[model samples]
Target: MQEPSDVLVLAERHGDVLTLTLNRPDQFNALSEAMLDALQAQFDGCRDDTGLRVVVLAARGRAFCAGHDLKQMRTHEGDADYYRDLFARCGRLMQSIVGCPVPVIARVHGTATAAGCQLVASCDLAVAADTARFAVSGINVGLFCSTPAVALTRNVSLKNAFEMLVTGQFISAAQAVERGLVNHAVPDDQLDQAVSGLVDAIVAKSPLAVRIGKAMVYRQLGMPLPQAYEYAAGVMAENMLTDDVSEGIDAFMQKRPAQFRGK
Candidate 1:
């Protein structure tokens, strides 16, 4: 495993698992322009590297992320273009995580508010500490969490999303899991182990199959039912032609574990 860098901190790797730690603990790992850029670069690197199979997004400190840095925003509030560009960049950063070829898992250990909660919802899977809490509280500060609502609405029911947006009240990790925002809720001490277990399960699969399957799921989810099925069938057909698929099937027939080269 590589050491943590000045930008995005990294740790732990066994084969294809890459754990990315958000490093701004002082501000609860708040999303800043520099942090966004660092995250984008890391996601891009992971996309181009076939050796990487999974990404674990974990943060340092007591909060996963306090969302966008209000101080940073205040510094450019007078400049409309600056504010627009900043938010646009943030959006792109979120999209990068969503569109990465490898599956991404969010390991939340603390409060995840506003855009932070959106980050959890955007991930392919998320496991949160039982002590963790989530909220979309931009409304309390006069700014509506419109951007966060985009992800929150898709992950949960309309009523549930609206309640969080309107009330700006915090919900426990269990509530997050029950509302479909988090995949599981475990004890704080077990968060790392739980994340590792889930990543191991992902990495055990053929990388090419997992990547193609993940991409197809996101693409098809936005289309009509029939069209979605058609798209999925196309993806499956293409995936079946890969060398990994052949090896996988042959290994199954031969009663052995498949050795995939991600071809």
Candidate 2:
């Protein structure tokens, strides 16, 4: 595991599981420029590391993330370029999470509002504490959560998602799961254990298959049903050629656990 630094992002690895914690607890892990860079750089740096099977996006603080740094944004209030570039950077970071080959799980606690909720939505799967809350709340400040909406709308139903966007209302973690924002909501004390259970399940399979499946699912999301099926079929064919698939099938036949080196 890597030692925690004074920097905005903290990275730690436990075997095949990598955990990235948003370290700015005082600011509620607001998405400052430094935070965005830290997240993007980590994802970009780890893009080729196939040995990693699961990435857990966790955070420290009373709130998971309070969204963009409004106080910081005020410093450049009239600078259109700064605002545009800032949001664009944030968008790229979110996309990186979606595009990553390994599955990313958001371990959420407390409030995840505005861009923060988008962060949760950006992950492949999320395990949130029962007390955690979520919202696309930029509307309350008269600046609608447009950037966050891209991910929000994709995860949640139109009516429910729109209500939260327009009203700036927060939803409980259970409600978030009901609306497709999170996979499960467990007790606060069980947060770490719950997330680890998910990680364990993910790492137990062929890492390559999980990676391929992650990429295929996200890529096919925007395609029409016929096109999606065609794409998946091609992917299935390609996946079938991997050594892990053969080993996995043989192991099942032998009635024993498969040995996978992510080959």
lDDT on C-alpha atoms for all candidate structures:
0.89, 0.93
Clashing pairs in 2: none
- Could you give candidate 2's per-residue lDDT for residues 1-263 as a string of tens digits? 45464778888899888999999999999998889999999999779986788899999989899999999999998999999999999999999999888999999999999999999999999999999999899999899999999999999998999999999998999899999999999999999999999999988999888988988888899899999999999999999999999999999999999998777
Return the TM-score for each candidate structure: 0.93, 0.97
| Candidate 2 lDDT score at position 187 | 99
Off by over 4 Å in 2: 1-5
Residue 192 miss distance in model 2 (angstroms) = 0.5
Question: Residue 161 of model 1: what lDDT?
Answer: 99
